[model samples]
Target: MIRVLVADDQAAVRDGFAALVDAQQTMYVVGRAATGRESVDLARRTSPDVILMDIRMPKLDGIEATRIICTDPALQRTRVLVLTTFDLDEYVYAALRAGASGFLLKDTPRAELLHAVEVIAGGEALLAPSITRRLIAEFASRRDPQHPSPQLAELTDRERDILLLVARGLSNAEIAGRLVISPLTAKSHVRNILRKLDCHDRAGLVALAYENGLISPGDQP
Candidate 1:
C-alpha cells in the first residue's frame, strides 16, 4: 500500500482528504497534521510514501517543510504533493524548487486529487501543462541569459532536443508524435534525460531546462 500523510491547517480539509485517501484500496493515510512544523515532524516519524501538504501554514510554510523533508537522503522515495489555491504561481514554483514532487489546486476534482497522489507516489509527476509553460516562461525571462548550462554538455544533441520539448510542456506521447518516434523510444529518452540530469521528474526537467538556458521565453517547441 502507498502510505500517505495529509497536512493542512483546516480540520475540515484534513478530515476530508484523509477520508478520500484512506478509502483507496491502494493507499492509506498514515497520519495528519495541522501545521507545517507538525507535518515535517509527522513525516519523519511516519516516513510516508507521499505527503499531501498545504502551501500555507502557521509556524512554518509548506515550502520549507518540503525542503526539510527532501533534504534527508533517507526520504528520497518520499514525494510531496503541495496543495495550493493558485496554479503555476510563484508559491508552487518555490515548492517545486524545494523538491516537491507536484502541486494540485485546492479545488481540484476529487478524482484528480486521488490520481495526482498516485502519480507522484508511483514516481511520476502531475505537472499541469499550462502551468509548465507559464512557469518556464516566467523563469526564463527573469533569469540571467549568461547562466552557464554545464549540464547540457553531459547530454547529446537528441537529448537536448528532448529537453527543449519537455520545457515546452510536451508529454512523452506528444514528444514521440512530434519527433516521429515510437512512444517507447520517447519514453526511454525522457527516462534517460531524467537519469542524466539527475532529476526527480518532469518538473525537474522543466526547471533544469529553464535554469540552464536550454529554453527561453517565447520559444516554441
Candidate 2:
C-alpha cells in the first residue's frame, strides 16, 4: 500500500482528504497534520510515500515544510503534492521550486486527487498545463542568460529529445505516441533524462530545458 500524509490548516479539509485517500484500497492515510511544522514532524515519523500539503499554513508555509521534508536525508523518498485553491497561485510555483512533486487545486475532483497522489508516489511529477505554462513564463521572465551549470552537458541525444518533450508538457503516454515508442520506454527515458540532468523532477527538467535554449518560448508541441 502507498502510505500518505495529509496536511492542512483546516480540519474539514484534512478530514475530507483523509476520507478520499483512505477509500482507495491501494493507499492508506498514515498520518495527518494541521500545520506546516506538524506536517514535517509527521512526515519524519511516518515516512509516508506521499504528502498532501496545503500551501498556506501557520507556523511555516507549505513551501518551507516541503523543502525541509524533501531535503531531509532520512525522508528523501517522501514526495509532496502541494494543494492550493487557485490555479495561478504564485505560492504553488514556490512550492514546486522547493522540490514539491506537484500542485493541485483543493477543489480538484476526488478521482484526480487520488491519481495525483498515486502518480507522485510512483515517482512521476504532475503539473497542470496552465500551471506549467505560468511557471515557465515566470521563470523565463526572471532568468538571467549568464547563469552557468555543468549538468547540461551530461544528457545524451535521445535524453535531450525526451527532455524537450517533457518541457513541452507532454505526458509519458503522449511522449510515447510522439516518439513512436512504448509508454514504458518513454517513462524510462524520462527517468534517465532526470538523472543525467541532475534534476529533482519534471519541473526542474522544464526549467533547465528553457534555460539551455533546447526549446524556445514560442515553440509549441
Candidate 3:
C-alpha cells in the first residue's frame, strides 16, 4: 500500500484529504498533522511513503518542513507532494527548491489528486501543465546565462535528445514516439539524464535545460 501523511493546518482540509486517500484501496492515510512541526514529527515517526504538505502552516511552513524531511537521511525515499491553494504561490517555488517532489492545488479533482500521489510514490514527479509553463517562464527570467554544465558533456547524444524532449514537457511515451525508441528505452534515458545531471526529476531537468539554454523559452520543443 502507498502510505500517505496529510499535513495541513486546517482540520477540514486534513480530514478531507484523509478521506480521499483512504478511499483508494492502493493508498492509506497513515497520519495527519495540523502544524509543520507536527508534520515533521509524524513523518519521522511513521516514515510514510508520501507526504501531502501544505505551504502555509503555523509554527513552521511547508517549505522548511519539506527541506528537513527530504534532507533527512532516513526519510530520503519519502516523497513530498506540496498542497497549495494558489496556482502561482511563491511558496510553491520555494518548496520545489527544497526538494518537494511536486505541487498540487487543494482543489484538484479527486482522480487527479489520486494519480498525483501514485505518480510521486512511484519515483516520478508531476506538474500541472499550466504550472509547468509558468515555472518555465520564471526559470527563463532567472537564468544566469552561463555556459552549460560540464555534466551535459557526460550525456550520450541520444540522452541529450531525450533531455530536450523532457524539458519540453513530453512524457516518456511521447518521446518514444518522436524518437522511434521503445518507451522503456525512453524512460531509461530519462533516468540516466537525471542521474548525470544530478537532478531530482523532470521539473529539475526542465530547470536545468532552461538555465543552461539547452531549450529556449520561445522555442516550443
Put down candidate 1 lDDT per residue, 1-221, tens digits, no spaces: 99999999999999999999988999999999999999989988889999999988999999899888887777878999889887757877878767787778889999988888888887743466566557655755677758565666788899889888887878788889999999889889988987787776677678777776777667775
User: Scored by CA lDDT, what does every candidate get?
Assistant: 0.82, 0.83, 0.84
lDDT for each residue of candidate 2 in 144-172, tens digit (9 for 90 to 100): 65764577677778877888888888889
TM values, all candidates: 0.82, 0.84, 0.85
Off by over 4 Å in 2: 173-188, 211-213, 216-218
Please provide, for model 3 over 48-96, each residue's C-alpha lDDT reduced to its tens digit, 9 standing for 90 to 100.
9999999999999999999889778899789899898887776787787
Clashing pairs in 1: none
**Poorly placed runs, candidate 3 (over 4 Å):** 147-150
Candidate 2, residue 155: Cα displacement in angstroms equals 2.2
Regions of model 1 farther than 4 Å from truth: 170-192, 195-198, 216-221
Query: By the TM-score metric, which is better: model 2 or model 3?
Result: 3
Task: State residue 219's C-alpha deviation in candidate 2, in Å.
Answer: 2.8
| 1 or 2, greater by TM-score | 2
Cα lDDT for residue 130, model 1? 64
By lDDT, rank the candidates, best first.
3, 2, 1
Candidate 2 residue 41 Cα shift, in angstroms, is 1.9
